[model samples]
Target: MNKRLLKLAVTSALTVAFAVPAFANPFSDVPAKHWAYDAVNKLAQAGVVTGYEDGTFKGDKTVSRYEMASIVAAAMQKDLNSDQKETVDQLSKEFATELNSMGIKVEAIDKKVDNMVKISGDARVRYGASDSYDNTDFRARVSFDGKINDNLKFNARLTSDNMNYDDEFATKTGIKLDTANVSFDALGLTNTVGRQDLVLGNGFLHDSAMTGIASEIGNLKLFAGHLKDSNEVYGAEYGMKLGAADITADYVKYDTATNDVDVYGANVGIKLTNSVTALGEFYNVDQGNTDANAAAYGLKFNKLGLTALYRDVEDGANSAYSGMHNDIQTLKDEDGYKGLEVRYDRALAKNTTLNLKYQDFEKQDGTEIDGGARTQAAINVKF
Candidate 1:
């Protein structure tokens, strides 16, 4: 057979064998009523053939042996039944020279296209009862990661505000863009700019969202940003490994209208044994009128999947205007609360977990807030 007729015959056979669902015709030249239209469109959708840069399927044009080999290589990557596999094997054998010259080029292109973008997300359903309220709520977040180039990347996440099923499930709709950032490497530093989450020194000092720029070199990171409430924040953190322990130091300055607040702290984690780890953090806040400190020490039993922490936060110790660790529920209502929190986590299934937590907290000045106790259970899932 002639080259063009041969190409048409091979494509027609493959199209009938593969039998993929029809897609919207992508090439203007291949009209619905044309004899080769269905075959061409199916082959294109299967990645067995790509017509031209201008998106035209020139069926009358002859295809070279190398081009036909590329088509066979692509068909080899598809999921095929026995008969289809035998036909592809025969074609591959006929074009062995071209396929061998191509080497890993086809595989590289396939991987690049597959890894160009990724989507991931997680959701949580939580039930909690405290002295003040008992409720059930749900929260979810979806994230997208895109590669701009070898050295640059883009990421964004959409988050839903906690929807309380106990109260306004039907009327509450609170979905928003929570994080959007682009990161790249330049000037011997890794840089990120945009709205992103910031967590400093075990979250004893700050764990919130900020919009600005951050740069990291080795174990050190520097950032300058503003909070949702318009409070300007600048911080630095350096982490190092000493002996068998990991230590991190943090410094953050918050620029408020009335005064500038400084929060500095250090966190250390040591593996006491193969199954036990010790964690501690100490933070000192220097506000214009209020100067206080916060400290937390915890023990994690890795084998048991349990963690216990004790927190003693003085009033005004947390300089961040928003965001706090949920381990101590009282921190949401009263800042100067001292508490002991214990949590146990168990794997329910792949990418799913069951978590139970209990906290007992009282005001630092010996007063009770939110009944001074809380219990919570949550099921977390990721996909």
Candidate 2:
């Protein structure tokens, strides 16, 4: 088979591999007698998956973030209907704005041909200095978000690095997830479901639990969803909150998908006057004899054009969906986080001013796993 066809096949198989509920198909170009025959064969026959030069398909091989985006781009381009065309246009504009945060200019995008939907992707060549290593990592991602309704939406995000001299190639080269969700405000309630994000304790608690979150009352909300425990465990979160007090629990799935990692947590929040506030997060994971305990807290003060935050994390939940440390747990083990952030805005002139930010992160353990800190400042001009 042509090499291009082979690449296309790999991409197609990727779609199945990343499916939230992965479906393994059984089939192969080789005869059934081969023990490892299935899925790829079917995908190949359907022109979706491909085999290797050695006539062997590494079905378990993980696809990385960049490879996934290229594949998605390829797959989406196959259908050039008018509906899909409109979607691409709108998506491009949205992604352009998102990439702006990383200093990428809208005009610099070099979208590949046969592109569908609004092709938006970003590349960041970041250099960092840490005790572990003074290194550089490149992150490139392409994504598309299509509106399903005024209150509903669909989003797919894919990202990966340029090179992998790190981790010994133990991880996949790319990452991707398809999210179909609904979010709206009505009847005095803001309800959101499908794939989503979660935040608690001003980020002393951040959970991309993805299950769901609803703002049912004033300055108060309720959430229930699935989260991952440990490095490779799925858990569910059941939580309730009122004002400054919140309590939550997780049911980890022992036998299956929805819930395998469990956590119980609580937080108390208080706003001091109009410019000062404080919050804290405490979480405990149930892993039988290996229960884990964690906590995090933060303080925020803003008044007269100044804002500051002091945040820290103990053993917390771990949700790797977003590079964010949603729970107190860092994605990497032997991790602990502590940081301080202060941002100030001074209106030097009417409709123009400067914004400044400073942040620092030091892990209890000497690994990048503790999650680094960010400090940045910028000037803004209003039209």
In candidate 1, which residue pairs clash?
none
In candidate 2, stretches whose alpha carbon ends up further than 4 angstroms from where it belongs are 1-125, 140-143, 148-152, 160-260, 303-331, 335-383
Deviating ranges (above 4 Å) for candidate 1: 1-111, 319-330
| Per-residue accuracy of model 1 over 30-89 as CA lDDT, tens digit each | 444544445444444333344444223655445566656655665565544344566666
How high is each candidate's TM-score? 0.69, 0.40
Error of 2 at 199 (Å): 6.0
Instruction: Indicate the residue-level lDDT of 195 in model 2.
Output: 57
Best by lDDT: 1
lDDT of each: 0.71, 0.43
Clashes of each: 0, 26
Query: How do the residues 1-383 of candidate 2 rate in per-residue lDDT, one tens digit apiece?
Result: 35434433543453334332322422223444433234323322323222343323444444433333222232232322243344433433444544444333343353332133344555433233323333333455666765555555455656563433334433655564533356667778666666555554333435344544444445446555554442332333455555544455433333234335455556655644434456566666555555655565565443334555554544433323323432122335534555565666543332234455555655645344433655333333332
Please state the error at residue 361 of candidate 2 in Å. Answer: 7.7
